[model samples]
Target: MLEMSNGSQHQTMKLSKNSWILILIFIILLLFFSILFFFRSKPEYVSKVDIALGTTVKVVVSSDKDPGLIIEAILREFHRIDRKFSVTDPKSVISQINKSENPVEVDEETAFVIERSIALARATEGAFDPALGNLITLWGFDRINDSAFKPTIPSDSQIEEALEKSGYENILLENDVVILNNSVKLDLGGIVKGYAIDRGLSIAKEMDPEATGYIDAGRDIGIIGPKFGGEYWAIAVQDPRGDSGEYIDLVYLKKGAIVTSGDYERFFMMDGVRYHHILNPKTGYPIRETISTTVISPDAMDADAFSTAAFVLGSEFSAVLLPVLGGQGLFVDAQNKATYTEGWSFFKEKH
Candidate 1:
């Protein structure tokens, strides 16, 4: 009887040990899945802001990991691209190409930008020309922020001479080589900011495919993925004739880009006349038909180019061009009447 009683107690002890082992395994599996779900279920958002490309650059990133590394990668790329394409920098590749008499070999980015600029110029029939560097210089916009900048309207002959050296046809690119006509210069100031924003957004996406983000490079903003679990981004349009903080419209977008070109952005007033930086290649003067133009497209670079082109072409032409480009636009005329394309109306909220 004593031996039997001892055997029964041993059996109970063994059973208890096996039960505890099973419970431990179950707890381990639960913790493992919980950790996995925490990372995979929802993403966290982090953002960074920096100044580059002569404008404010803001980036918002969503990821499970901290976004410091991603933001640094983006800003580094912006700085590199800015150095390669800046016309103001005498040592930049674009400046080198402009100064060289022979065909100049440039980086891939410069070549691509020049190619795209020329195509857009052709498409707009020279309404947006990047080869107007001479005209821009004659108008004193090239030396922006210069203390010696005396705002003087050039003589008719001077304007004509500057126009002589400016034409989209003067730029030729073969592979990585860019050849410009004599005395012709290239200024990418109008489009580089948008390109940089696109590049930054691409980098953020590469870092984390599931991440959502937006990069705003001054007047241009590039959005990747969706916001706050598939919500659209809100963009406000500046009122051209109103006070500084006044807005004319609001745009909601899930992805793609939005860019604006306005006389209010950069200009000098002399003798009660405004001389803006966006020069019409044909007229050698700022576009006056529209006070501001905004374009939304799948490509930020296209949006940037179109904004300037539409501003030059005015409301009638822009209304037509916007649809052809598979984009939408809002043009503000001198009368403060906002004209929206049919597609643009989709984004506009009803009053």
Candidate 2:
């Protein structure tokens, strides 16, 4: 009688385990279907694209109200920033400051930009430099976008001369006045586009606080809000070695900025050697160690500047540096090896 009772208890336990396994399988299937349904029913968005800030600028938004006005306002803001900050535009304030030998008195906004740039330069120990205008000119990169641009390598002596005339130490600020010494020219190219993104998003938010979409200025994106007002957006990083649309990796984000600095952007090949525009201030030559650096940050200015700084400073240093600056970064070397900060994986979707 005892053996028979034990046999019946074992059968009961086996049946209970089977029942739970079936229930768990059903639950997972339900979740998978639910996700598909949610994505299929995502909210629609409207977008507009125009050329601004020396790159293709696109604005996308989904709001309860019409997004047309908001998009126009944002584009107008980009044009305004471009007008004020374009280093190539002789009429722009930056060009005027670069041309001026005396201390240039600037507005509060310009002063803030200069001060922030100097601060970032110090923070990165001269990795992200605005004082590279002279070096840029020596390489003729200042005219890279022009139709008549001719690619020629600068002599080592010329590079050395430009290096001597350039450094963050050339800048001195005194209560809304900017003084550039040692032939250093202020090129806010590193940080201006990010500032434009931030300002464009702010304009969208001011018009509608719950604006859902993103501002993509030449592929450096700043999220205005969550995708479809709830879901995360899968943002792709471009592969430096691949074609224009080819992607290297992807990171999912609901908010903030994703900015990339790659050697492929503005480059000229010379006798089988590709000469790109991302020059190291320290070496007065193009950086060869890093192929690209992408940064995710709460602010686009930080994202923009740090991406450039990381491209010059190498991937390992950014592992510690970016986190302290409220950023997560991915650094890809010339051999295509990738390095990520500790928090970078958290932004990626789990497989």
Candidate 3:
């Protein structure tokens, strides 16, 4: 009887070991299925595509979608449309509709930019003007590559000449046709990239309604939709110094554009002082008093234009001016103190 009892206990111990093994296997399988379900329910992702355009263009899109092919097509179309208005020799376009003579015809892309520029100029009361191209070129800010050399300050006479040649009033656009007076020259550099970013986002949205993406064109950026797991796109504000990826702060953005303009971005040092690219339309001198200005708006064009305008307007006026112009802006003075409009706080990410 003692031997039989000992054998029964051994058998029971073996049975208990097998049961535990089975339970462990079942738990592992359950966890696997849970993870699989979670991922399957989540949206698929796509790789980022870098597009080079005026200044620079880099975009990040959904992985499930082909950003490479899509960006290529969009860029091809943009150039094709831009060629009509562009003068290859001068490498610029005339974007005014004149009443005195037959208006120059522009493609859909150029026409759209002209319209946007006109609207922004009117809204800002000449704070953001495409006609500032001559002044930009004079200041050497029109170079395709960001130049590190400081341009000699233009004399008062040169500024006067540039000012005479620069004005939105010199441009005329009617029914998709644009004309420019002899003295007027158009430079869409400030607003065109933002417009293209918007266009790209529009295409991406059409392709996948749920897809989230962002476009970074040098300092101009636009975010569409939310990030994976329904998070906002975190954007880093780069430090103006040459150190790459040195971010001042990370801003959470959704379906909006953030543009920054600063004196430290592209400039050369002369005798221990830095001379940057952004020039004031009024004085034809590099804008001072503010280190940087960032503007966030529903439209990339508005954000781009306003950021530059706020920089030009200086810190004191920008605080009051941006709201009157119907936008939210942030100004960082030379001392690094940040100030923004009342609406700018809503976009800040809480730690």
Q: State the displacement of the C-alpha of residue 159, model 3, in Å, after optimal TM-score superposition.
A: 2.3
Q: lDDT tens string, model 2, 1-351?
A: 112347446432334677789889999999999989987744579899999987899999998877888899999999999999988899999999999999999999999888999999999889999889899888977788889999999999999999999998999999999999988988888999999999988998999999899999999999999988888989988988889888878889888999999998888999999898889998899999999999999989889999999999999898899899889999999999989999998888833
Of candidates 3 and 1, the better by lDDT = 1
What ranking of all candidate models by TM-score puts the best one first? Answer: 2, 1, 3
Ranking by lDDT: 2, 1, 3
All models, RMSD in angstroms: 8.2, 12.8, 6.3
Q: Write the per-residue lDDT of candidate 1 for residues 42-122, one digit (tens) a residue.
A: 436677778877667877777655577887888898889888887788988888988899999887777788998998888
Cα lDDT tens digits for candidate 3, 94-181? 4233222666776776777888898888776776788776777776765535446345667889988988888787888888777776
TM-score of each: 0.84, 0.86, 0.77
Global CA lDDT computed for model 1: 0.83
Number of clashes found in candidate 2: 0
**Model 3 clash pairs?**
45-63, 45-64, 46-62, 46-63, 96-172, 96-178, 96-179, 97-172, 97-173, 97-179
Query: lDDT of each prediction vs. the true structure?
Result: 0.83, 0.90, 0.71
Clash count for each candidate, listed in order shown: 0, 0, 10
lDDT of 3: 0.71
